[model samples]
Target: MPPITNVERVYQERYAEAHAYLKATNSENPFMVIRAENKFIELLEEPHIPFWMRAQCNAILAGLTDETADARKYLKGAHTSLGYFVQIRELATGSLSDTAGHRLAQLREQLTKIERDIAAREAAKEQRSAQNLEDDKEMLLEGQRSAQDLEDAKQMLLGPEQEMLHEPVVTDDTRALPKTEPKPASAEQSLEQGTERMDIDSDRSTATLFPPHTEVTADSSQHAADSDTDMTSQFSDNESTATVKMEEDDDEVL
Candidate 1:
């Protein structure tokens, strides 16, 4: 049996109340021993018992602290203290069952593990956030560099184009390239040159290939006819002279 708490004194003081509560209930038919035993056990289960025990222990401890006593009072105080210790132990270990303690221990372990897991996850998330920030910084730098390069390229291109547009087309150096020249020949010029060449060729064509042209001479033809007439007259005169000589010779022969 557990040692008596200070409630033992209270129950001793109110023994009549316990007896009256027993008489009022069905517990009256039973022997007072059994009835009192059951009622006392029920009283142990009451909310007031723990507070009452604590107050009694504090009172005893206070009295012991105030008094410097010889051997008998000291022994009595020790006995009361021992009894109070036993009652507290019974309230703590006896009322709080083994199963309840086990359950509480499991809950404590689970709560601790959950807290540790949450902490680790938060740390990892913070690390990832830092890495993401670094990556974003690099990306921003790369974007700025690309934008700068593109701007420089655009400026260089526009400068050259402006210079080319304002520059002169012709140069004093013969080695310098000429600008876009005329691609087509004019039709009137081609036709005039062609007609001039055709006229010159016609004027000199067959005459130049053979001899020079000459005038026909009518006087030469008349002179040749007169010479033929003179030849005919001389032949007639010779024939007449020959006839006359033949006659003279005939007379001499006679």
Candidate 2:
């Protein structure tokens, strides 16, 4: 065979790269799968003038179509990828056509398995959500019942006197009355109060003259006698002071 031209070599390399992406879709990584699908589209967009190039393009298209069909089935849209698989299959030929047919068979098997797994997971999730909702509802009702029971117990435990404390005191005159200032004491009342106060002071002084709960011993009698002598001396000094003032007046008059 003659050495391949640069253009043919390039197409071969790109064809292999596209196939690698197609195989990557099996990994089930969403981002990697999306990138692989885009790569396939890019290769299909290239000019496939040569028969070999066109065959490679057809193979990539067939793979892409099957992958998209599987995804669409999960999304619940058109069960088919708009008849794209039929169109790509018609374009495939020889070894390329055989490869596409084998890949499609494998993809269909994988797609069926994936659908079952997805359905099972979704059913389990919905069941768990429903159970959690029921649990929360029961808890809320239990809390409300507990509160009601506590209130009933409170009513049973409280007597009439305790209940009366909680009740508002209602009266015929509910309106507030005008505030009245107090009157000042009259002169007669003031004089009587003063006299009463003086009498109280005199009684307090007399009580203080003798200590309470003491025996009348000779020492106590002597202490009383000493107090009387001190008072008499004070009176004599006052009288002497008045006599001095009177003598001075007489001298001024003379």
Candidate 3:
């Protein structure tokens, strides 16, 4: 085998140091575990690390953060780093290949879980937004109905006064009494009244010409008989005068 170059030697030393830190993470001391995790983070922060080394560092950090709030970020980093190494066909030992495969499987499961959780949260948020909008619309409609009810109540309370105010005013100028004209009598009624007056006048004239009759005594009865006898004697004298005139006319003719 060829001797290792200076660059190769430096890489081996750094790699050995990172491996020592990974071993310290198993210590019972909490401070040592934190220190080891910090060492891994420091190596990963270096800009010139090899893809295989970065993949191992990221995989360790992903396992550390697996149950923590940083699981998604670290898991995604480990997946990406391992993908880059595999895409470039990097030479991995049996143990390293096994670790990469295991870490990739774990990362994939965690990433899928995180994505599913995110989609569920987004769906819930949209549902809540739609519910809130519907609540607001109901509130607006209720307010409008309340306003209309108030207006209707006000109109009902003031209805009588409004009608009175609109009523026509009554004054002396518009209160003239109606004139009563006498109805003209019909011709039949006039004729009836005239006939009644004529009957009354005729009764008055007859009463004036003929006085009321008194009780007849014997002397009044004898006077009526003397008037009858005088009327008979005057009628006999008229016949005797008419005969004498006829006798004179005969003597003149002789």
Q: Per-model C-alpha lDDT, please?
A: 0.60, 0.68, 0.70
* Ordering by lDDT: 3, 2, 1
Ranking by TM-score: 3, 2, 1
In order of listing, the candidates' clash counts read 0, 0, 0
Instruction: State TM-scores per candidate.
Output: 0.25, 0.31, 0.33
Question: lDDT of candidate 1 vs native?
Answer: 0.60
Clash pairs detected, candidate 3: none
Candidate 2: regions farther than 4 A off: 1-79, 82-100, 162-254
lDDT tens string, model 1, 156-250?
98998999999977566865666788767699988998999999898778567654764347986788789998999999999999999999999
**Mind giving the per-residue lDDT tens digits that candidate 2 earns over 112-227?**
55456556655866998999999999999999999999998887888676979997786856446766889999999999999999999998997798657767899989999999
RMSD to truth, every model: 31.6, 19.5, 26.8
Instruction: Give lDDT: candidate 1, residue 115.
Output: 41
Q: In lDDT terms, how accurate is model 2? A: 0.68
Cα error, candidate 2, residue 63 (Å): 28
> Could you give candidate 3's per-residue lDDT for residues 1-254 as a string of tens digits?
88977766776577677567556643232233333455566677678776887898789767765333344455456558856766564454433577767776775675566556545655866998999999999999999999999999999999989999997776667456676889999999999999999999999997777766755689989999999999999999999999999999999999
Q: TM-score for candidate 1, please give it.
A: 0.25
On TM-score, the leading prediction is 3
